[model samples]
Target: MNRISATRSELLARRAGIRLAIQGRDLLKEKRTALMREFDRLSADAVAAMQDLEEKARRARASLSEAVALEGPEAVGSAALAARNEIGVRLTAKSVAGVKIVDLEHDPVGRARTDRGYSLAATSPRIDTAAEGFETVVEVLLDFVAVELSLRRLAEEITRTTRRVNALEHVVVPRLEKERDFILNVLNERELENRVRLMRARSRTDERARQTGGLAERSPA
Candidate 1:
């Protein structure tokens, strides 16, 4: 009786375990799908950001070239040096959904520009041209850094999420399923044995009662 009871208990436990494992697997799959979709969206955004950076870089370079052509090299160089002293770029980190980005600020470039910006002290046209080119190069470098950092953060987050999903699907779910099956098999065997024993005991009790009646009838009463 005890064995039968234990077996029944084990069977119930196994069934519950199987149910929970299945539910967990389904939930993990859903999470994985959501993460993948996010990764795709981030990738698209990164591509667009790169394109925008490139376009801005080209514009900056062209502006510098025109400035140098009009003024001499010496003039442009002096302006660039003055701009450096007067202008400052600062980068600050901002977070969005656990990702961090460098936000750049140019303090001097737009701050002091009157109707006509600071005059270049020109020595030669070539030098002026080079000075203009330098400004464009600086702008391009700043844009590149921002885009690269953004992409790096996104990629790292995607990798971390993927690893967690794989672990749930391949490791945790399978182990739970295997344990549940083992418990079920053990319970079924115990149940069958209990049934057989109960039948045998009932047959013995019936035979004893019949013998007692025969003895009583045979005696001189």
Candidate 2:
């Protein structure tokens, strides 16, 4: 432990530092609270989205299986290849309670049969139904993915902010306070020592003056 100077200047500096640390701690606490709120809200949303995605996925798989059984696997695969489209996504950054996360944008899926790139005459109704189900599943999955990613980012930030708050509360402020108290004690000790020395010096001076007056009295006038 490094010893701080036992001076008024050092004391003032330490006090100021303590105040700043307190302010920092308060701000971080507020930030942590806000982050937790956001995380909780996002978590609920992500859970719902996940549930929706799962249901849609089950439906899509069932439709695809039925299509395969009716029209054969080779026929469905050919239809999928014929109906493929170039999927694109646009991602942007957004902040929630000081945490930056990604915002996703994409074109709506589950298009009409005319838009699926496969011809209605060439493909069976089962293939079209299967394609629609799968497209809906993809749409729900994208939404779920975005929510999950945001939740993860928010959780990480909350953890980081909480750690900082803990450090200030448990470590930094207490140490500075201890140092300030140490300085105060040292200054008080020095003041007491100085007072004692001054009192002793004054007593000696008075005794010597009295002795000199007594010697003068004994001499002839």
What would the TM-scores of all predictions be? 0.62, 0.91
- Over 143-203, each residue of candidate 1 has an lDDT whose tens digit, in order, gives 5666566667656765765676566567765665565566666667777888889888888
* lDDT digits (tens) for residues 44-75 of candidate 2: 88888888888988988999999999999988
Q: What's the C-alpha lDDT at position 192 in model 1?
A: 86
- Relative to the true structure, how large is the alpha-carbon lDDT of every model? 0.60, 0.88
Give each prediction's root-mean-square deviation over alpha carbons.
5.8, 1.9
lDDT of 2: 0.88
Among residues 3 or more apart in sequence or in different chains, the pairs in candidate 2 whose N, CA or C atoms overlap within 3 Å are: none
Candidate 2 least-lDDT 10 residues? 94-103
Candidate 1 structure, TM-score to reference: 0.62
